[model samples]
Target: MAFYLVTGGAGFIGSHIVEKLVRRKEKVRILDNFSTGKRENIAPFLEKIELIEGDIRDSGTVTKAVKGVDYILHQAALPSVPRSIKDPVTTNEVNVLGTLNILMAAKELGVKKVVYASSSSVYGETPQLPKMEDMQPSPLSPYALSKL
Candidate 1:
């Protein structure tokens, strides 16, 4: 049986992804700190998922959670620009360092592709209408720079 691990699977978009994976008849697990994610989001499909309530910045916790997972979806992040601006330390701890923890765990466990979520605020104050992937960034906020 193939196993899938979704970090921050209790959040809005992460919950949707976890629901789809569960519907597809795949073995799935979740890692969430519950800092921003709401419990109600995943309450409907609790049976199918093994929820691990822990911070992603903790490598030991993350590493332990990565076992027996064939695929990984890293959706955990400090997504709000305003929050990132006001409290960048926690934002970086969760968004950047936590993402790094996921990457390290994935690499060590030999898991397949890991899709990590990123904020669009990296687009900065550029007047460019349609933002492409490769744009010279001009970040106006700390959150924007962090994402960049």
Candidate 2:
């Protein structure tokens, strides 16, 4: 069975991904700070998986969690735009730096693949028709910049 390390697995989107993974019979581990993610989101599968309550900013914690995992679904980030604007430092720490930490851990652990969830706000307010991956990026908020 492939092991999946899901960061931010207690948050809105992460929990759903984790639930689906659990149902597929995959060995799953969750890494969450619980800053905005709720315990209730992950309560349904508490007994079927491994839980690591820690922030992604802490290298030791993230590294330990990523160890032996074959795949990574990095979902840990400060999601709210207003929240990021209110606290850019924390937002950058959790979003950008935390992502770097996970990437490094994945490299060290020789993980097969690392998947990231990036938003489509990079194009800003331009009246562009189709949003393509190669388009120029325009970040309006710290949240958008972090996701970039």
Number of clashing pairs per prediction, in order: 0, 0
Per-residue CA lDDT of model 1 for 1-148, tens digit only, reads 6899999999999999999998998898999989889999999999878999999999999998898799898888877888877898988888788888888989999998888676667777777778887877677776676666
Which residue pairs overlap in candidate 1's backbone? none
Q: How many steric overlaps does candidate 1 have?
A: 0
Local distance difference test, each candidate: 0.86, 0.93
What is the alpha-carbon lDDT for the whole of candidate 2?
0.93
TM-score per candidate: 0.91, 0.93
Per-residue accuracy of model 2 over 1-148 as CA lDDT, tens digit each? 9999999999999999999999999999999989889999999998999999999999999999999999999999888889988999998998999999999999998999999988777677778778888989998999999999
Worst 10 residues of 1 by lDDT: 139-148
Off by over 4 Å in 1: 127-130
